[model samples]
Target: MPTRAHGLRSRYRSLVVAAVAALMAVLLSPAGAQGAGSGGARTPLSEPVYSYSGAVRESVWVDTGLDGDGDGRDDRVAADIIRPREPARQGRKIPVIMDASPYYSCCGRGNESQLKTYDSDGRPVGFPLHYDNYFVPRGYAFVAVDLAGTNRSDGCVDVGGRSDVQSAKAVIDWLNGRARAYTTRTGGTRATAGWSNGRTGMIGKSWDGTIANGVAATGVRGLRTIVPISAISSWYDYYFAQGAPLYDGGPDWLSGYVDSPEALGRCAAVQQRLADGAPRTGDWTPLWTGRDYVKDARKVRASVFAVHGMQDLNVRTKHLGQWWDALAEQGVERKIWLSQTGHVDPFDFRRAEWADTLHRWFDHYLLGYDNGIDREPMADIERHPGQWSTDRVWPPRTTRTTALHPGSGTAPGVGALSLRPARPGAAETFTDDPAQSETEWAADLDRTTTAKAGFRTGRLTADLRLSGSSTVTVTATPTTSTAHLSAVLVDLGPDTIRDYGASGEGITTLTDRSCWGASTPGDSACYRDTAARTAAVDRTVISRGWADLGTYASPGKGRPLTPGRPVTLTLDLAATDHVVPAGHRLALIVAGTDRDLIDPPGSTPTLTLDLSRTTARLPLVGGTGAFVRATAGSTAADAVSMAPGARGVTPPHPAPRVPGDGRP
Candidate 1:
């Protein structure tokens, strides 16, 4: 999301100026600031002090309100207009930009500690860093509003996304009409921008991202741009991958929303705002409006600049695919950036870029600023091993498909093998005891251990990149009536994985998974309706497909150790971004459960993995399926490799022969 890393680029220059100002005020006044002398006028200003960098002048506050929805509740808002102290421009109402968010009351404007941290470069870094000084000095009139239900704003917090939109409109109206702090020579509306939790555009990412999407889709006139950074397009998939219910992430988020510190010390009262299991209301209710953002993202008419993490665990790139498809159908001006960094890090930078991008967009559409933003590439993908490429659009126009065939004991067999196809009829089987409670792949524990088995295509010799589905088909027979199977696709080694996903089955306190069909209620299952299940009546072949929940059922009246009866677990591997070196190998691991990356111990039904007949289908690109040959090594030093994208390639990264962790 971020165009630049935090602090790497200056973001606190204004605070330093403010500190100087406060110091001068201390020296010039009867008493010095920071208690340097007998406390001068110890009276704190009723309103926040304002300043514009690059200028000697500072504008005071102008408070105003409007009936944005005409509901009688005067939504009080504030603005600070900063012009160059030197001279005035002729007949030009400067384009205004502001961020409307619900992070805190008064949009964090009244905090003095926020004022002092502006560094020499004009960036605000400290707790009280204000946007007014940063943007206003740059010829922008900045306004920050206290969203409804906070401070003097009216109405309740529509966590479902309604009040925020109304507040945005009212703030805009006030900006155009009665902003009392300064006079405007040129007259027209201005641009708005925000980052992280702010209500800027229908920007996607975490919770704020979702609301942005919802807000923009409303087609509100003032909403000119959307930057959904690591936002969840599909709530269900955001929480659970491969159809495994996220039993933890949901409740924790709900708890935070209900008890946000803004409601005084009434955490309990906030928690009680909506009873557990209470249906969501307003524009967000699909049942009422029959319009779901996931189902119809095209409703968002605003130009969008979406940012996604290639390794975002919580909000997978797959969700970004959903957004892409919708935006494409809408034919809206859209661009996507897939990066190698973590969600939060990228997002922080994305906001500034978003702010800049919106400025150009509004200038072009609203103010007629021809910044050539539309001429930029439609997609920017940070490819693995470190490189960046631009595309006119995503799913690249020149993508070629290849298949990888799976085999036993790392050896090539006879007949034609796919470029990246599954070895037909090949299977692996193993026993899973839910009672054992083992660790799984990556971070989540739901994919706990039965017997960890993985296959690797020896190092790419050439860069191996895939952007679609990765699947595994296993014929499994449960000693018990039912089994729970979770599958994950990891980049392997230290550099491939990014930190943004759930690490275990236990309810996570940081995110929500309702859209991904993983909901939690007080640390218990809230989306049990989607939990995998099976029939207890017969010893049948239950072909439970992956990309959805696995089965959980009583094996039968007796434990069916009948061995011969076969069941199948078709696992849908999560998408990945890996750069297998000339010597490294690409590995696919299968387990009864990956405890670390999936459900926790004693929390859910257990799954048994049968490795004997497991088969994986891998997609390979470049050339007709059989252009390359593959080989495996019995020992580390003897590992295989290809003649640099020539054909059968061996894994570049050597796997330690002795398994340090029993669970792959």
Candidate 2:
């Protein structure tokens, strides 16, 4: 029916049309090997606009390139991902929110203690914490990674050493197409981060948060920001306070607590390394340098949103204090929140406010939104339970270090602290008692005791605020070659405060529940409410410090004493923000081993101090003149009673005894 030339032309045109259709399909497939299709980028709104419960879920194993357990193969870290399905269906990419932690399979997370659960196909079903539920619908992907040596990963936990930090970094590298990932641990099939936009932000609490700090210090390219809550800046600070061992066998103990079956089979050599590195000696070691993130602050390019409890005895405030100062020195963009609680997360302290603020923070950094969070004050400090105040920066601009000298009082071992120096030859002495504690020393403040030496300033006419860490310098002659000293600053008066030592560590969980985001039958966004637990106390320990007499000058080595020879040592106290009311006196007590707080010295040593050479440097809101004016006309004669208040004294510092607590 057609001529020869016309038939040839029609078939040729059909072949050309078919080729164009095939090329387009390959370029636009959402699950293609190349990431972030050539589609238009999605602009983010201030509110959620996608599905969370119906999010796409998958699993991958990222290679860390380290045989930490001597398995003769590169280690692989397991990463479980949840992302909005709408983006994948539309062939668009989304930003990532990652949390790399050893606790995903061990101790659990949040107030409800939720762990990761798996579906029949081995994909992650119940992702712990509320990040997945809240952010996925906001066009973000949440990746919950099981750190090396824990859960389904293949390696040994190095306990904040090279392996722990790098494993997390590997996942970040994979998202940027710089590292290799596999669909299974066996590693025959390759997997890719095709859903990622290559921008990432990390968020976590405690040890989980600690990994965020370590990885950021590596100056990784994809990391935009980090939120580390109650985390450690230096692993050395966690086990040793200054040069005193808080506990022995710290690293190995934690590693064993979080190990998986795969790790247990090959981590023998790794365990031995930890023991040989930390020898129960208080002196600094090379192992500590490898774990210290503060020293690497210069390498950090990511902005920080730090949160910490003012009274957190576990990770302690010094970690945040020193890290904050170091970050500031490098001019890293930062924001902070100091709570009145102890080792508690803000989600439990201020739920709705924390969620909204965190949401906006992620939006500003990851989504490139023009939120005014960066223009606001840098710090939010809790003045008291349920009362929060903002400041341009911490330790107000007027803060100055004031030196106070001690002079003898009417009673033995009791003294009055004043602005002027004491007589040159004046001295005070006390014997160390191994069985004594700060609680025992505080209770007998008015009476005479050989267990400790007490000093106090006159009652105040107006409020006096102390803003940061204080240092105590004592020139003493020890009766033994080595000794231990505990110094505590106190506000001697009656006041109601959060009971941090209680079971909940400053909060009581309520029966009622509140939801944050979308929920499914297996995974719910609902969490129990919490309330502050208060206690009326006669005196509050404002700040405390511990020191081993031998390691006074250097954190690396110890200086042995010649029994009766005079030696000078400085004690570094914990950081705090507190106000001494008009009716209260500011007091200091120097004593022996703090019973349950730290390990006791091998033998009790008696020490004699020359009051003339002993002084304390307090970080007061203003200089000496302001402090003198606040206590204008007041004298030692106005001291308040040392007895307990309407409610008895609060309990001692809480021990990290919870089985799955994930403490270092």
Candidate 3:
């Protein structure tokens, strides 16, 4: 009963079985001793083990679904890649570490002011920062992308809009084999990311990190995690603060600043859209919504390792605070590092610790390594310069809002900040003066000034630690339809602190260089070392807020008030975590027109505050009972003079550095 057809079928089955056995034998041999990474390549330690000098370096133009330049073609993003040449040639796939930035070409990056350089064949030779020098030699591929409309890319600058986000996301798609790319801008052959394992980690600072946040919000499949350092979550918060323009004509100018030279006359239309969409009246338009990534955090598939400076006045702390809160609400995996510096990258301030933690984070997430990062504390906070501590979470979960009311004091406008409310109809008044800054308004805490109204608590008997955002609710009557108000929470005491208001923004760059990873002729891992800039100060502004009375009702809508009519305006203070020592007193200064932080308003109006109605809700570690006990040993004299009343020197750096803040 053995038919010829049956014999042929049996022979075929035998051949298939033999082939599978041979394949399994080859896979399980001694040649497969590449460690136990489920994702292919493996990194055994926190240091680089693979070869960096022999890495394969190349460039590609990935196609994107954007017509930012309107040239009848899709915009192509420029990406420079560096990976281990031997492993990549041997058909070994690896995960990617990407940094997509607009600053790569125009302003440079990091402490050294480095820009990417290419060789004769248009292959990358010089890579900015230590990312390539460090990670490329650690079984990882480093990809530095020029955001659309910047550097060698083809497009118009859209700032944080669709073009900027989609272009970067398209590169991840290509790495995952879902999109197309080519060797050159015009054409050559198709460039395939065949050596990649479709896993990526994005890391950057400032606008570069912002792009990472934007891409992460898209829930991009290949993006495993993001390390956004001092990044913005919402573009609206960057240029406008609650319907108040932080400065005039922000969108268009920033777009043109980062755009390539080729985008000269071609991007006028895009620039016009930016200018037209962001109305001066500060209305929340469709343009800002497109740029707001915080609202879309629920769609994020990537774990976030957020690092922010509590004193980062440029991008501000609210961006990270709100973004982190949103991420937590979604129950996303997160870790945080809060520094006492300003607008600074941790690599420059806390180099060793940051590098080690970053290495472990990438290993755990992207490489499927069983590192104990999740078991470690969730927060690494630089409590003071050269001092760091860890916590289970940020803002310490024990935080509660303690409302402190302002009351009458014997020293004229110098009022008292206390748990008990002031008598009804006890009002204080001040005229808006654009000339006086927060520095001037906060000086001489016990003295009366026409420029501001001050309230201070008695000398604290115990340490009070504030760890979150604060809000000031002002119940006031304005003399005119247009009114601008400012509130500041100050730590009124002398303390040796890292001078965040110093010329270096709390970090001084030294000429002496330190190497992090292996160095090549063109690109080195060595950078100028930095140290903390310390200062002796009597008073330090802990947190501050500003409000345009026209937008009192809502942040999106601006409505003018009736002259002499009272309106309650609540504004958000910047987030913070500071410890007021046992002897220092906490003070709240209410003023008009914060000339140092915000642009001057058009009209100057005098405002009268109903002390009984106005109050500050602080995020103290413990509630009112804690505050009452801390300041229990209080007297009228202690209230009159804030503690640590030493001779204070004026810091060299006093206000926000505009053009300088955008760089580095």
Candidate 4:
């Protein structure tokens, strides 16, 4: 019987309100409507209540208790079949929705109560309900499964790869056999929809999302449309932003996989095991090429609707771009939505829209309804200030770029002067003190607050949106063979801010866009001095078949450079989509590193910038020419200074202080 817990429903209702309020404050504030009634109708927090008070007609659990791997670990697992509360008079073979999740199953009790609940008064009530609720009444059955290594399931945790695939096959086989004995409408046809980490859909948010992408790669029959919300295209890319690994989220994730308290107490055990597992050992190696979803995008025949949050710092918006690129390359028919909040936000403010989107997708694919989901734009877009646009393809045609120049003596505090290309007259120079501690465009890694001889650009009012790959082309004469130069795009709105670090790649802070590509790919011929060193390795094996492969070579030093010719450094900024609006002047500050942003070696130098010969090519939209004219000097100084309550720019958190360097 479904028992609607009024207490839980009330609490969840409050949560829905709170989530909307927070999202509105962040996203809908400038629209002049800051309250509940202003935005679109908020979706109800809970799903429609369903009753299971009458006879279940059919219910059974199959044993998944034995360890298939024969690793001496027995496991417990099972799935329950729930007949539709209402069946068609004329038997109809209805579709099935298989909800696969990593969450522990309370021996089928918890899973059943998720969709159908009752109040203390014995009245049915649904809380945190979803699309699956409408299925039963429409002659459909749902199978909720406990993935391997989860509650009552066997085998070690496989994060949605082979383990999930095998599990899905097992559950599907079981469901098909049981449906034959039932006289209800759902006793015939089948399909799947996974929520969260459920493996059924092979795609959706979090675990479910990744698995969907993986499952789709297999081209499983009967597997149709996959609606992955905020899913990761590549596990490596998800866990590690670029080369730097994501430390915080990964640990939280491991805890859930081994749900038991005792299993959790074995944290060190699991940690060690996983370290020896595939993820940690890979280290961005070529081996990951096997799991690269983008490479197999063409093989993914299932229709897909990938939804992502534009401001999702945790998941990072880069995944959306990566997926978009892959789908484009495959020429696959796909749908995408760029939501407004962070990862997995509640379905309140944009509830109707989200529900409508999902309903249409499932209806068209699963139920075979022609709901025009195909008629919509391929790419669902969102710009600033409630501007929601759509396009036949991603990275809309209007994604334009604008260049901001870095000039001499450009410190956080110093105002930029009107810059014009010099007649090749003089070259600016300054000593780079590696020990002095410097900051990148985004961090405080170095102790020094600012460096000497940097440059910046003035302000503008038009919102600047740059997508895809961006490069920083610079001409520099390094004093050392291995020199590191950083270029930062500072939001000179009202905050002198810097957002850096590997995690900082997808985040839109006051400023970002700093990278180091080989100055000339491999300009080894220019180097004059060189040195080499090597280390010996020793290995020993443990009784448990574990062996440490001893030490590998320590990082070696590259050839040093002689102090003569100036070379151009082409730095590849990670592909990002950010808009610096009109009123907010985009300043490009150049320095050794943003002490607050990057952690360079203790031996690199803090050098000066020569802006006289520097050039920038900014993509201007609806404007004439290939670039926007560089504006510096007094006009720039007045435009790009820090002020309070500045419009168009997200205010800096914790506030920013002027760097205590004399150059400014």
Predicted candidate 3 versus true structure: per-residue lDDT over 195-249, tens digit per residue: 8989999999988889999999999999999999999899988876766667434
Model 3: residues with Cα > 4 Å off, grouped in runs: 1-47, 635-664
What's the residue-level lDDT of 107 in candidate 1? 25
TM-score of 4: 0.58
Instruction: Flag regions of model 4 displaced more than 4 Å.
Output: 1-89, 96-99, 104-129, 138-143, 164-203, 249-273, 277-282, 286-291, 346-349, 384-387, 398-457, 461-463, 468-579, 587-638, 641-664
Model 1 — which ten-residue stretch has the worst lDDT?
A: 534-543
Better of 1 and 2 by TM-score: 2
Model 3, poorest ten-residue lDDT window? 26-35
- Candidate 3: residue 434 lDDT (0-100): 84
Question: Residue 428 of model 4: what lDDT?
Answer: 49
TM-score of each: 0.57, 0.91, 0.91, 0.58
Per-residue C-alpha lDDT of model 2 across residues 476-531, encoded as one tens digit per residue = 88899778888888888887777887767788999999988889887898999999
Task: Go through the candidates in order and give each one's C-alpha lDDT.
Answer: 0.39, 0.82, 0.82, 0.42
In candidate 4, what residue range of length 10 has the lowest lDDT sum?
Answer: 539-548
